[model samples]
Target: MSTMIFSRTDETPGIHGHTRDCTGAKGSSTLAKLGKGDIVVVDAPDINRTLAQKLIDAHVGGVVNTGAFTTGNVPNFGPQMLLDADITLVENVDPELPGKVKNGKKGRLNDGKVYYGDRSIGQGEVLDEETARTRFLDAREALIDHMEALSGNTAEFVSTEAPLLIDGLGIPDLDVDMDDRKVLVVSPDPQLEEKLKSLRYFIREYDPVMIGVDQAVDELIGHGYRPAVIIGDPDLISSDNLRSGAAVILPADPDGHAAGLERIQDLGVGAMTFPAATGDATDLALLLAEYHGASMVVNLGPTLDLDRVFDTAAAPGTPSAMLSRLRVGNRLVDSTAVAELYRVSRSGGGWLWAILGILAAVVVIVLIAGLSGSDGFVDNLIDSWNNIALKFQDLFS
Candidate 1:
């Protein structure tokens, strides 16, 4: 898919930037380490929006991927995103090409030929936006085939994990009380930050058993609400927050290695391990809530997309994710619904109840602090609710 090259518009069609090894295989983990203007050398064929957004956020200058940009089997949405951001994208390079370019070394691109300090390291086809868009349209035709394969895999997973879903075989007990209560599970999704701004009021009202996966837990803690459980690695959260008495559950490796156990032990924090979960940790978090007898669960993350089964970085529609959703059924409430519920309650004639709820919450916080020696927890709850009240007063008055 050769197209016109305007990577650099000066005289020659080329770009010069520092080279960095960043395999798309490692997903966002590698992208998070990159700095602005560094050229990423990656190995992702079906790059999705999440990966591209990470590169955009890191302000990378270009991408050198060994895999063909689009093979018609899956969509390569990231290529267009990169090209739109004015980042040069060269693909189908030799498999060994990424290794020759050392990180922090100035690498130059001239008409799809990669050079490491004036020496040609490899040659590949560079893509323009028009060509990438054409390929992406063609790739959509193949998504049904991919969906069929994923459906087969989903059937297998349901057959394998049915016992856990039905009988609660591997679900663990937690210090947090969840039975008959609503559960709020937050994950690292694009909408998480903005959605939480309004949903914090829902938190104030429901006081759902809070579960946070990945660094999204920090968002909740920053809003003055500590998660009752943290379902990612201990290192994923701040050290101070990690010690704040949340039930920490790290996902074990598929081969039985306890992932993040050592880090939790090093931090001297109490933690447990969920069996290696399929897809994202957020899936397991939702399943955990469902099996723990949560009356309802509110999921704060990317809505599932079955077409993205191949995206390892939080593909919303992985087969395992499908299974988790099927297991949770209607109990898994979307954040949008939660938002609507909050709006309705705010508009209805219920100001007296809201005031009474806040007053009762304060009394409960004081009693819990006095009886349980959780002074810090009480203080945070008070501060968070007080902030909510001040905002409400400002908005109405």
Candidate 2:
């Protein structure tokens, strides 16, 4: 239990999720100002109480919850624990809504009763759940639109193309022969921490490059691994990490905190700054590693699958960044591979038996389906054949 009090002036729609999950465009920006050890009191009572408890567990200080804990269906114990722990709890500041007073920023409830922060000032009203969700979705759509708009723009084309020049040189793949290439990716969010940790074994074995995007550097440093490459603009990642000896690749545009080429020069280290092409630089860093001939680039916190892409792309610049990397043949490591490798490496007889059982089951299924004369069975067989055909297309197309 940490004991301190801090205030958030901005009550952005997504701040609750951001503070809890530690991702999202505005959340990342705010989180960069606070670290693992810092404490801040929040004004929003509508925040998920579970998230509040998580923050307390992580040693966050007392919160001055403005709205009554019960107003938004958020947990009661979340605030109760703070009171139980003797953490400062302030409630019912009516003249000045608890959120506004705690945030120390003036805001107004919109016609729809949602909080809309002034982008320039970084302050907004606290929105109700329905409005917040709607705004969040809109923000996502806007980001996707931005990514699409920037994908082929000259700035993106130039930045993305400069690296591809190496491809034309016919350079042999650079052997990532360094046995010491072990990497640890970090994120402050527990869910993200679990996600990254899931791939720990694969990261350890096929270690090629250690790359951290934004606050991931803090997470990595906490785990005793200094990143070789730190991607993203200086907005979210502390200037201290950027100044540290790690190679800093800045973003191109201001939207995604795209590091400027000049900042790369100022860093006074071997650095690469890409034009803020349409995607996040984390994706760029991974592709850049692959393009530069890393034998096996094992991403610790890299985004994989369509769902993750959609989630990450909801942020302003991620959509274009992801789309651009996809064009460059950047390989998104499969989560299944992570599970398989871990099982094979960690499990013994049980894994072997499980594999044998799966193979036997597959064989039996194919034989039975082949012999079954019913139309349903035949339809299933044709669907399987089409799936195989699609896989072949993916492999060769």
Candidate 3:
């Protein structure tokens, strides 16, 4: 997420705004209909950073969640995220608040109580910046427990899927050649459009095999990058984009559900399935890229922080995210790392090219002046160059 200026002051924040029901946010695209400064009510326990980022982007005046904002099960940075942005976060409100509070109804949140047009709707634990910070620190103390759980789950995953992980069984052979190519697997995210815009330089230079994970194609196409391959639920993608010639890699878990297979069949489009797929679409894409001999598999918009992993992860079943990363090993690079290194390299490299071009132009000009056998030609050229330099300096300054 990008850095944002905290808009709060040293005052008891009493926020009043219209309500927007976001209880089943995962089941629908609610952000499109959501207006700026609308008070959002969601039912997310241990709200992930990704969803928090989206809410922050939506410019919601406040949030009323039916579940614990942090839950203390994992070190979730979401509560603090909302607090940091000066957005009032009232957590653990009534579960049936969504039913009681209709969308577009005016509500005021203050001192842990929610009032819908002067009538008290419900009350919950209101989180301020300081309280959230303390909660987050306490949550971090449970990291050891979280790590143990992750290790145990990953062990269980490996033991059950030994044939797939150890023997490379069920990995599909695709017509797309991946030998020595840098495969870029992009997942759908609220921050994806902004992130991709920044990485335009890297994409242009490497021209990596663009793999869109589910609705990520929307952002990729928005940024003018056509996906070379799509791996996810085809239902999430537009019918028009699906027919855009990109090969589809559908997730077919061993449980027998092939996501979007029916849709693809209806469209008369062919697809390759990653049998017994596990994690999310992005994980399967990583596994495919790594298995197909991709030199480097760059995952866009996923954090290296394990604490935030599962919250945003396409995990549990499709492909196991933890194991998939383990399988890829050193080849897997997050977008942040790529951005940091590539940006530094180009910042210096650009000046070198500019200097070389300037030197070459000077030599040609001097050679012309000498060949012309005119001292006045050289003087005229110098005056013209000085004038151009002053104009450029003026423009920039």
User: In TM-score terms, which candidate is top?
Assistant: 3
If both were scored by TM-score, which would come out higher, candidate 1 or candidate 3?
3
lDDT of 3 by residue, 1-397 (tens): 8886874332335777787888764424665567678888888888889989998998888888898887765778898888888898888887777777777876777777777655777888887778777777877776665566666777787887788877777778878888999989899777897678768889889999989999888668767888888888988998878888889888887775787899999998888887764637777788889888999999995654544553323234412766778889999998867887878998979989999999999999766654553557767677667777999999999
Q: What digit string (tens of lDDT, one per residue) describes model 2 on residues 1-397?
A: 9976965644443222111213233544443344333224344544555656655665533333335433432223355454454433333334233233223233323221213244321222333444444544565565576546545453555565555433422212333332334333332344555656666666667654677777777766665566667776565666567777776666554333444545555655555546434446565665556555444444555445443433433445544445544643534454445657797777767878899999999999787766665568678678767777899999998
Off by over 4 Å in 3: 1-148, 277-279, 309-319, 374-397
Worst-scoring 10-residue span by lDDT in model 3: 310-319
Query: lDDT scores for all predictions?
Result: 0.78, 0.49, 0.79
RMSD of each: 15.8, 20.5, 11.5
After superposition, the stretches of candidate 1 with alpha carbons farther than 4 Å from their true spots are: 1-137, 277-279, 306-317, 344-397
Residue-level lDDT of model 1, residues 1-397, one tens digit each, is 8997655433444776777877634544666678887878888776778878988988988888898767666666788888889988888988888668676787777777877655789878988888888888877755665566667777777786677667766666886788989999999877777888779788878889989998898877887878889988666888888888898888765455666788788889988777744636787898899988899999888777543454434332476777788789989898878898888877884888889999999898666544553457667667666777899999999
